[model samples]
Target chain A: MTLELVVTLIIAAAMFGTGIYGALSQTNLVMIMMGIELILAAALLNLVAFWRYLHPDAIEAQMFVLIVMTVMAVEMAVGFAVAITRFRSRGSVEMEEAQELKG
Target chain B: MSVQVIFLLAFGLAAVWFGIVVFRTHSMVRSALALLFSQTAVGAMFLVMQAEFLGVLQIMMMATEMSIMAIFMVMFMMDPGGLGEMDMKHQRKLSLWAGIIAFGGASGLALFGDWGPIATQIPDAGEQVRLLGIELLGRSMLIFESAGLTILTAMIAATSIAVQPPHRPKETPDKSKEPYQVHNHGGAA
Candidate 1:
């Protein structure tokens, strides 16, 4: 593999690792969402990298990446709404302490 | 050195650096911001690979989404400043081990795999943009529309739920209780 590809891969891996860490580590609801967003970005990195590597000729990968972007926007809107509801109802946003649905 | 190699190295190093920052930080907003930078770097790498469409998409989506996340952090989260340290209770060791394994496996793959040369030589980069536009509007039309609706719904839901109802003051005393003599005295005054 070329050095450039190697570097890209390394970055992508780091993004992935950090994303997982964020998603898993933070207890605050917003923090967890941020972590999830990071993970999504990491996954997008992998997609874009592969797109550049093998599909330079076709625009398919690029188009697909755009779709992912739209999805991300939608996710943020919905996620924030859910978080707001939780905050309003319970007066807190910490995921660890939320047990309204627990049996 | 080839342009691809140079672009890859720059983007890769930036991503890793930002990624590390994201992991190390306790603040959610900072982590989100770090992730945004890392995404941008990765997008740059995509441009190097000549996948202009994906690269642009990466920047637009990743950056905007992260910004929205920051907004949510301010509005909903009790501590808008993210002043306190994150609750890192059980998964620290597990996350570390998983991260290490993932990194090692990725590095090994990178070392061994010979990613072939760029698939096509573009005589006109402009045409690629037109083609990408066609693809997005044509093949991905439904997906795009749905995404718009989803965002709209989320906006509505968040605003409706987050805002508290205005408190209405009770004007009348309970019928079970006698009227206060203070009210009659106040009327005389």
Candidate 2:
């Protein structure tokens, strides 16, 4: 409930909102992934803020942050790999034409 | 406000601004780089908040990750340079409304929620790092190992997916058979 904590939380929330907008609005697969990255970044910001302001002695929060970072790296790798495969097969990475799974 | 709070606000603003820039730019490469700057600003905020190890790790990891992302942006994007001036988004009004609602809801929660007691005493950077290391190796060892395994699996899967299959040679027609061989055993000729 400190000023700093509130400010940090608000900033995280703003990033989260922006991320949602980008992810939902972008037509490209990579752009959507970028939005997801921003969302994850916002989560990381919140985690670190909570650890610093509420439970400074709990180091588990830091470990959680590291795991989240690893997730981000893994996500980027897998997403780009999928993008490359899609590009090779379809000649473009736009998501609008990816309707093979439509039921 | 304390110096730490001032620095925190400054970095926070930078992060938010660059994050907005990520979606606002037309060029894919610029968007990627803007995301990088935004994440770096978040790391700087971590530093301002006195989480030195996490801050350093964030900056270093994001630097390399975002560079690779930028390269991929150039490779996969149809208009990486923004020369085409194509609109890259869809459902703009819906997204805008969703974003506004999300921001308002989250801001309300942050402002009105009761976050109990704040801890004023924080460990120094070195001590925090040591404690984090111990936590990772001690109680959270299983989680750490699982994450490592997951990353390894993801790497292998990505590499396999990205690799092209070998091209097979075309089969040649067999020439051993007699051409137009017709057996006529009738007595008439």
Best by DockQ: 2
RMSD of 1: 9.3
Candidate 1 TM-score versus the reference = 0.76
Q: Which DockQ value does candidate 1 get?
A: 0.57
List-wise, what DockQ does each model earn? 0.57, 0.68
**Each model's backbone clash number:** 0, 0
Give the per-residue lDDT of model 1 (tens digit) for A7-89. Answer: 66677676676667666666677666656666666667666666665665656766666666666666666667777777766
Give per-residue lDDT, candidate 2, residue A56. 95
Best by TM-score: 2
**Model 2 error, position A21 (Å):** 0.4
Q: Which residue pairs come into collision in candidate 1?
A: none
CA lDDT of B138 in candidate 2?
99
lDDT of 1 at A82: 72
Cα lDDT tens digits, model 2, B1-189, are 878788988999999999999888888788899999999999999999899999999999999999999889888875634545767788999998898888888878888888877678999999998998899999999999899999999999999998775573554757886454344679477
- Give model 2's TM-score versus the native structure: 0.90
Q: What TM-score does chain B of candidate 1 reach?
A: 0.64
